[model samples]
Target: MSESGGTFDLVILGAGSGGYAAAIRASELGKSVALIEKDKLGGTCLHYGCIPTKALLHAGEVADNARESETFGVQASLQGIDMQGVHKYKDKVVGGLHRGLTGLLKSHGITIVEGEGRLTGTDEVTVNGAVYKGANILLATGSKSRTLPGLELDGEKIISSYEALRLDRVPESVIVLGGGVIGVEFASVWRSFGAEVTIVEALPHLVPVEEESSSKLLERAFRKRGIKYELGTPYESVKTTDSGVSLTLKGGKTVEAELLLVAVGRGPVSEGLGFEEAGIRMERGFVQVDENLHTGVGNIYAVGDLIPTLQLAHVGFAEGIFVAEHIAGLNPVNIDYDGVPRVTYSEPEVASVGITSKIAAERGIETTEFVYNLGGNGKSQILQTQGAVKVIAAKDGPVLGVHMVGSRVGELITESQLIYNWEALPSEVAQLIHPHPTQSEALGEAHMALAGKPLHVHD
Candidate 1:
């Protein structure tokens, strides 16, 4: 490879959420950056992951509202969904965001390289036989959806989340393998789209990473939606029948569906990128990074899904900014991964920040919890949504966790994370008033109860 592309101040390996962010921010701080990517600029989150999945979820919401319009005093009939139109809308949204991102990178004066990148040296990356060197290198290679060892993704009967997004019509029935965030989100969409969805999880509950209370509420909601789920049962095998698919469980139980979606999770894309060959330390397929995102190789750093802190796009953005500032000698604060907000955008969305009750107990922190039912909130009754706000505080200390399960509760998690990260006591949070009749008031009410001044809460 010819070392022709001259040294830059910083070279970014992927233009996903983290890499693009670092490129733009480092450029703002007076560092010339080279942003290299194999596919689209916005990467999976914009093209296939967050943006598109959320659009499908929104389409599901629209369908649900139409089906249940009679309760709102509107006698409207729900017609069938046109998957073509849904895909059109999703693609349009993704394209607009991609264009905007491209424009931003151009305006920031960052060089965008279009090809596959590999680290040949500590401060160098080679793309299509062309070598680009930088005084410092940042790797943000991102991740890809993972599949089971024996399950082969044929992209038709057996599919990943990427293929599920491009289906032309809703399946009559779907067997979703995995009860985590990705599986549940797709299950919610398929159910709302009028499909008979069955979720299978090896875990004891759906969304098992969330608070136990939240998981129970979600299971109830899913049951009410007529979405069947088999928990604590491991998958045995799957075979494509003439029409759809036949999935077998450990107990010889069989499920027939038009499709099977594999949503186990995502794995870092670090295999063939030459990180190990270049002597960068890696653990369990993820690059090992310090608190400052350093890769322990000469001025090289890794961020985003490449480093296993959190696989969220927002987390990637924060890591990117942190790396950029740290490289620029600004010495930015390290991200507290525990305090990061997590949201599962399913029906009756689940959102939380900080440790759960289980985690707190595991850490030997005694806690006092208060649950505020949304049924008392005027807005919740008006919207006909059933859920609650839960505040988990220390026995006499600050709030450690805030977990919510309800419609639009994801929006309130920002405030919840703020309270957790700030180490605000229940009394401190109770001093402020949440607007009356709003869903957020449930949060305020929970805090009030935690502070020993219960309002609209039963003893």
Candidate 2:
């Protein structure tokens, strides 16, 4: 192979959400950028993670709607799931987004390099014997599915979310290991798709990182939906059975299923990538960076799942933009991770932003919280969904957090993010009228109750 050399203002490794976002922002700021990826662009999110999973979730939602159409007074009959057709629909969405991203990158004049890249120096990366030099190098290698030491994924009966996504047929029964976002999401989808689903989590509650109240609510919803869970139990071992697989929990409880999905979590893809060789500090495979995302070695920086932060795609996007603007000498403000909105797209979606009550207490801040049942919301009643909006605010101070569980509550999180980031007071949010007969009204009503004016709610 002929060797080539090119220099750019920024050379980004791993053209996922973070790398691409940085490239676009840097290019927009009049800087040359080279985005390198070994696999397809848009990375895991578009290929196997967020995009495709959400498509499956949406399809599952449709199946659920059809099954429960009698409640809505609609004459739709419940039908079997078509896994082939679901894959086609999921692929179509991913394909369209990938095309748009490629076009956007090209329009910005960003160079797209297709190869596995390694940092040879602080300012240099070598890919396919071609050396690309940059004034700044960003590591955005993203993450991969993580599994336990003894539990090996054979990609068949024992599998991860990646393999689970590509399954041609829904299993008769599935045991999901890990009740965090990924695990719960897959459980929801499989349950809606007519599978007997069970979730195993070592934590005391599902979505353990979320507020305890939110976790309890989600657990209740899951229980009501016939989803089984073994909470606060650790995994011991697994063995492939004649039918599928059998999982042994901490207490010697055995659970059998046609498939055992190890949705444990994702680990950073930083090994054997020359990150440490270039003097970047790493702990447990995650690159350590300062608040500004600088690697403290040279002009090198790291973002996304490579860094020890919230491993969300949107977080990666924001971090990428921040790094680009920082490199451009714009002095961008540091990201307040707590203000970031988080959504779990399950049957009854969970969305939140800012600090929970537990977080406030940990920080020694006194707080008061209010919960507005969606049962009182007209739109929620119309949609036949049951959940609530929870608002947490400082004692006589600003709104500190907002959490919700209901259908399509993810759509309302942007406003909650603004409330949390701007530190809006309960009264301030109460004064602003949310549209009548909408799910958003739940938030407004919660704030109103907290602000000492209960509307359509018993004080």
Candidate 3:
């Protein structure tokens, strides 16, 4: 192979968040890099995950708000949702991001190989049967949704997040399986579209990873939306017919719906990835790496969902930047997984970071919680959503976890993540005055009370 104009220093697979981030950083460091992507540039998050789902959720919120206008003393009318228009808007959103990525890659002068990449040997890779040699190789193949045994997604009745994102017609009724983040989110969307949704979760609570109190509030909020849930029960099986799907529960109870969404979870995509061929170490399905994000193989690295840390798109971006900087001879800050915030775009919008109150107590840590009622918040009252913020902290130390359930609570989690990760004490946070008559003040008040200096708490 001709060395062309220059010899590439790094070659990366999967032009998703991690891959493009690595390529851009590497280019900035004066490294000639080649990025290979089998599909569109932005990958899953832009195409099917974050961007599209949020758009749908926003539309769903609008639909619900329009229907509930009588409570606000104004009559708003909604004829029906145009599902085709939703798809158009979703596609338009995705296209804009994809175009931006293409422009950025071109400006950086990085070579774009449009094909599936596989490892042929150490420091060498093959894309579309053409060999490319680099000083180092990075594999960042992301994950896909794991299907349940008895409930496979067929894109019509049984569906996954992807199918949910591209739904052309809103179903009259839906039985959502696995009350995880995705499940509850779609349940919110389906319910807003006037579908009677029943969520079946094997866990004892909805959003099991969240604080128990937050989960309870979410349950209460969901019930008011006409969404039914069957928590702590396993779904026996799903039978699809011409009309729709029939879901059987553990107790012989059956739920018939025009659609069934299986939002169980996702698994890493490592099969046929050619990792073993390159002699890279991986466990089960995830790539194994060190603190520096380096695979055991010389100069080769792995990051993102493949690393088994937090399977979040933002986490992948951070890891990709970490890898590029480490290669450029710069020491980057290591991410603490505990401090990484997780959010579900449901009606109540679950978001949290650090330790839940339950986990802290189970570990024998002394903790106290402060709950701020959303009804006490002016902005929440304005939106007619009185969801509260719950903060857990050490008896007299830094904050442990912050959880919330109500309208528009996801935006407040950033403060929680920062405080927990920085070990910011309640006294320290309480000293800063937040703008009054705002929902964020709810956070400030919660901190003040937790610090034993009650501010807005009625005596």
Candidate 4:
């Protein structure tokens, strides 16, 4: 097809989680769809963010487990880490997902267009100077790693998470800035992979967005692993010399390392996309959309990090599917941002959905919280990690939140979010059994407490 392409029902920009899901849904609903991307078929999450990071974490876990195998009554030992082999494994995981996406698009009849997409007008998208008009447009270009001032990333000594994920050789020593989820997750992976890693976060605790107690557990766990850090105080600046990076801290403390990973955070990738000329409303850099995920332009919608909603890949997927259904006249159920689950997949993984205990207090919902210790869980003892599950509920109403920390607590977010978002009552959740002798029993106990009957704990 020429640059002057045929009309489509939907023209989606950036085929990552949101864009691809939207295209498939639109096509299944009998809409002619075109998806444009300048890079990989799957955006950062599939290529760099989620899939590859998890692969690295798995490898690191295996390495660490092998080293500590004696405690598990096994004599497992590791030969050295094969850095190239690590990369090979990560790439293989990403490749499988890439192929899966390709097949899904082909079967759904969504046309894939290769090139950068720009909204030249309200309903017009130009890819490689080819104009394609759509009845509607979706902008899901996603985001990029954001760096602090005076800390320019060269993808080397001063690197970004992008480089951290593709390291061919584990650095002998590394300094990480930003103790958020990304920073700590990489810290966990590298610590397990046998890197001398130190995390420097400006917050008083690691994973600042999580519950204070949860952050404390993660900090204690990392310390147990001997991962060092100068946290709570910001690093004033990073000076790179012939040898390595020298980070100057607030208290005039200085630390040096061969490499630095900046996981400060991510910013929306919306520049040069022509949103200004298209007349779509925007707040800050994110596109402004309504409850239906519709942009100000009648036939235009926005999702993913491009919109001012949550920047999570799952949120993007949900928003994409929601918009497609609204366009197809499905009138699907609206999502409560409060109900969406958020997880940090580090050791003693932090997960939560709905209002935090702190937020519940501020919002004044007359809230009460139930705490169930992972110390009592048989599975937690087996894994040698102890944490807690916190359930927040209205004094006389439904569940308001669920927060968890323990080995592999990320999986709990799914069930927690369901209870919180569905406005499920304590009685409702108490009715469900979470299986026997599993870590999930912690949640069942929390629900039981809120339901006026206690299980595994005396009230």
Candidate 5:
């Protein structure tokens, strides 16, 4: 391999959210950086994962609103979904964001290397027969869609999220193979687009990682929307049929659909990139990092989905900033994983922050919990949405967790994130006023009830 003959202060592999964030922050802190990416600069979140999927979800929302316009006395009707037009709209949104991100990176003056990079030494990454050395190397390679042991993605009858986003037409029927965020979001989108959708989850509840109450609420909403789901049943096998595909569950129950989407989870892209050979510890393909995200090998570090963290894009962004500051000797604080907000942007959204009641019980912490129904909130009434906000707190301590299920509750999660991260007491939050006729008041009322005061709630 030929030598590039120059060493940067920081070299980041994978120009996804984490890698680009580190590059920008390190450049701002007056450090020379090299960002190597084999794919688009904005990475999965930009091109295929977060941005495109959310765009499709928004289109689905528009379609739903049009179909139900008479409920608001608007007297409107939704025409059939045009797949080509929907894809065009989604592509436009992605294109604009991609251009903006590219310009931003250029303005930061960080070197962008276009190739697949491999860790060759403690401080060297080889790409295209040229070795680029760095004072510190960061492994920011992100993640990809995961499949079950016997299942394989063919980009046709059986597919992953990547192919789902690029489909030219909506299937007549679909069987989504998981019930996590990705599964539910796609299920919601397809049902809204007028398709027969069935979700088969081995877990007991949809979005099992969320609070049980939130999961039950979402399940209720999905039932009302006519989204079919088979819970607690593991699929034993799948076979492609002439019309589409057939899936068989453990108990011999069979499900047939025009397509099957595998949305179980995402696994880190850490294989054959020379991470293990460089002496970096790994667990199940995920890089093992210390509390500070250090690999304990030279000045090497790993961030984003590459490490076994939250895997959310925002988490990746935060970790990237923290690592850049740490490398700059700014001594940044480590992130509290619980404080990161999680949102599932389905028709009736689900959002939460901080520890769940189950997690609290697992940690042997005593807690007090309260649930405030949206039925009591004027804004929810105005929107004609049914849901509730639940808050969990220490018996005499601060707010431990906040969970909500309703339309657009994801927009309210930032406040809950702040409250959780600040460890604010229920009384403290209750003392503050939320605007009248707003869903945010649901959270406020929940806090008030938890603080021994109830206004519109009957005891």
Candidate 6:
């Protein structure tokens, strides 16, 4: 690590969600930032993960709507999915966003260094024998899709989400390993694209981190859509067949599919990046940081997937802003991780904010909950979606959590997050009138019931 150094107010490694965000904000506050990246500036979320996946999911929605148009009293038929066309659209969306992000960073007067950056010194990052110095260093290396032991990715038969995203066409059948957010979302897309999809989860339920009731509803919906899944089944092994791949479950049951997608989870990309070399403490490859995102080493901070917080990009954005303000000596408020919203964009999307009922009881907090079925919702019936809105509150206190499963319920979670973060009581939320015949009314009804008013909900 030779020093051909240039000093800056801040040095950020890995120009992903957190890194770019911090760079932009710090620059806005009159701080010179050196933002470095090995790959694209927008990183995995924009290039491979969120943006492209959502585009494919939207394509799936289009196919689904076309196929089921008869139910809407429309004569329409889904001829077939043109994956090339779909990919073109997805790439267009990604390209536009990437250009905007790149332009934004440049417009903010942030210096973007393109290379593989490693922390060679406590406040210095080395890329190609060139050292960049900073008053503070922020690590936002992000993450990569993880694979199981003995499961080598060939990028064809056995693949990670990265390779899966580049598939030219939907497989005739897919065995999705792990039923977390990534698993269910990809499965949802494949199923709607007319592919046979089966998900295998070692957990008791799909989307296991969500409320158990919400998981059950999604499972039921998937079943109705002919999306197969095996719950509480551990994966044993896999072998590639001439046709595709064979996945063996723990009980010796076997599943044959065109491909095996290892969507188990993402792991921090903190290894071999000189994190420990710079004396930055780490835990299981994740940079260890305090609530303020400080890494406990001189002028070092970490954010995004690299630090093991919520792996969502928005969380990364929030952490980036927090770190910038903290370094500016602004005494920024610490994030309430519990209040961060989570969503799984499946056919019946799942979204929640704050704590689940299971967590409430585990913490010895008394709670009362009310469920408003989407069956009674006018908008839901019109959309032909099945789900419910659940409101959980302290016995006589503020609304603590709002969980829902239905189409576009992710949008409603924003309001739920506001209610939870503001510590609004059920009565407080109930006082606000929700517009008539909308899916949001389901949330309103639940809050009303929880507030003891029971509007449109039976006692």
Candidate 5: where are CA atoms >4 Å away? Answer: 1-5
Please give the CA lDDT of all the candidate structures. 0.93, 0.93, 0.84, 0.86, 0.94, 0.92
Quality of model 2 by C-alpha lDDT: 0.93
- Cα lDDT of model 5 by residue, 189-275, tens digit: 999998999999999999999999999999999999999999999989999999999999999999999999999999999999999
Worst 10 residues of 3 by lDDT: 1-10
Which digits, one per residue and each the tens of the lDDT, describe model 3 over residues 101-135?
Answer: 89998899889888877877777778766777888
User: Which is the leading candidate under lDDT?
Assistant: 5
Please list the residue runs of candidate 4 whose C-alpha ends up more than 4 Å from where it truly belongs after superposition.
1-4
**What is the C-alpha local distance difference test score of candidate 4?**
0.86
lDDT of 3: 0.84
TM-score of 6: 0.98
Score residue 50 of candidate 1 by CA lDDT: 93
Over the stretch 1-459, how does candidate 6's per-residue lDDT look in tens digits? 123558999999988888888998899888989898889989989998999999999999999999999999999999999989999999999999999998998899887887788888887998888889999999999998998998888998998889878899979999999999999999999999999999999999999999999999999999999999999999999999999999999989999999999999999998888889888888889998888999899989999999878999999999999999889988999999999999999999999999999999999999999989999999999999999998899999999899999999998989899999999999998898999888988888888888878867654
lDDT, candidate 4, 1-459, per-residue tens: 235566899999889989988998888899999899999888999998988988988888889889999999998899889989999888998999899988888888878888888999888899888888899888899999999988899988999989888788878888989999889999988888888999999989998877787888788888888999777899898889787898999999988888989999888888878997778777778888888888868689989988877778899889889888888899999878888898888776888888887888888779878888888778888998878999889988899988888888888888887788778998889989888778888898889888878867854
Please list all clashing residue pairs in model 5, or write none if there are none: none
Error of 1 at 325 (Å): 0.5
Please give the TM-score that candidate 2 achieves against the real structure.
0.99
- Per-candidate TM-score against the hidden true structure: 0.98, 0.99, 0.95, 0.97, 0.98, 0.98
Which pairs clash inside model 6? none
Listing every candidate in turn, what is its Cα RMSD in Å to the true structure after a full C-alpha superposition? Answer: 1.5, 1.2, 2.1, 1.6, 1.5, 1.6
